[model samples]
Target: MARRPKLFEAAPGSPAETRCQLCERAVRHTSRHHLVPREEGGRYGPTVDLCQPCHSSVHLLLTNKELARRYHTVEDLQRAEELQKYLHWIRRSRVERITNRRRRR
Candidate 1:
């Protein structure tokens, strides 16, 4: 049988832990999300920490071009209709990590 991915313990207030910018959930691990696509010339630009699921959802819902042109800031990303729905759903869960199923074009 395949093993499950490990979940970080739900220890509130750990110094190393941070909140997901999108879902606003406190999680142990966070991946940096480039405000603009690196290929679109934001290699040295701003970034925000997001949980894996939230980060993956952003890429899944919006194209790199869209991210580079429109959703380049956390405030902009938060206002996106596509992401607003996802944020609402994910915020209800206490689990720090959730599985993301990528959609094929």
Candidate 2:
């Protein structure tokens, strides 16, 4: 029998070990998303745990231009109370979107 490497060990120093900063979901097989734009001095921080669908939805619904203008990195977001508020807002919005779609029978 072969032993699989722990996810954290495979991706050493990854932020996925932490629950999604937005929805509080445990991150698994997650991709790294810069809360702040790297080009704008954004660095890594708490990340959202989005299953592939959720991750795609976020990018589709929220434009890159908007993200670039709003948050360049997690560090930048942590500095602003308003952005923090929006983090929760975005989480709720995602839940609502998912729920509403499920209920549209």
Candidate 3:
């Protein structure tokens, strides 16, 4: 049997161009962060790269009782279209921030 390739290797090229989904910072040492908890059948497809700080922040959000309470099951997270929308929104926002920073330089 063959070992599975690392996500970065599987999707080769430069991650710096990929952009962090949370802060829109250049993704250095990028790692896939699942928007929905993986335990709830959230696979890699629903993943996005996030910088360390943003990644930590995401986990923090999940830790919140209110959010956790709202999402009682993996189906709840998956079925909630707003969650997907929010992920896209965060990615776009980050991209905008990155573009703005580039303009400032």
Q: 39-96 in candidate 3: lDDT tens per residue?
A: 5555553566665544554454454343345654435543444456555555444222
Model 2 misses residue 47 by how many Å?
7.0
lDDT of 2 by residue, 1-105 (tens): 997544232244566454444344444545567654455445554354444434444454455555677655444434445444545555444232222322221
- Name the runs in model 1 displaced over 4 angstroms: 1-11
Better structure of 1 and 2 per lDDT: 1
lDDT of 3 at 22: 50
Select the stronger candidate by TM-score from 2 and 3: 3
Model 2 clash pairs?
Answer: 36-72, 36-73, 37-72, 37-73
Local accuracy of candidate 1 as per-residue lDDT tens digits, 1-105: 998666665567777668888888888889999999899999999999999889989999999999999999999999999888888888887666556457787
Candidate 3 clashing pairs? none
Model 1, global lDDT: 0.86
Task: Evaluate residue 81 in candidate 2 and report its C-alpha lDDT on the 0 to 100 scale.
Answer: 52
Query: Would you estimate the TM-scores of all the predictions?
Result: 0.84, 0.38, 0.41
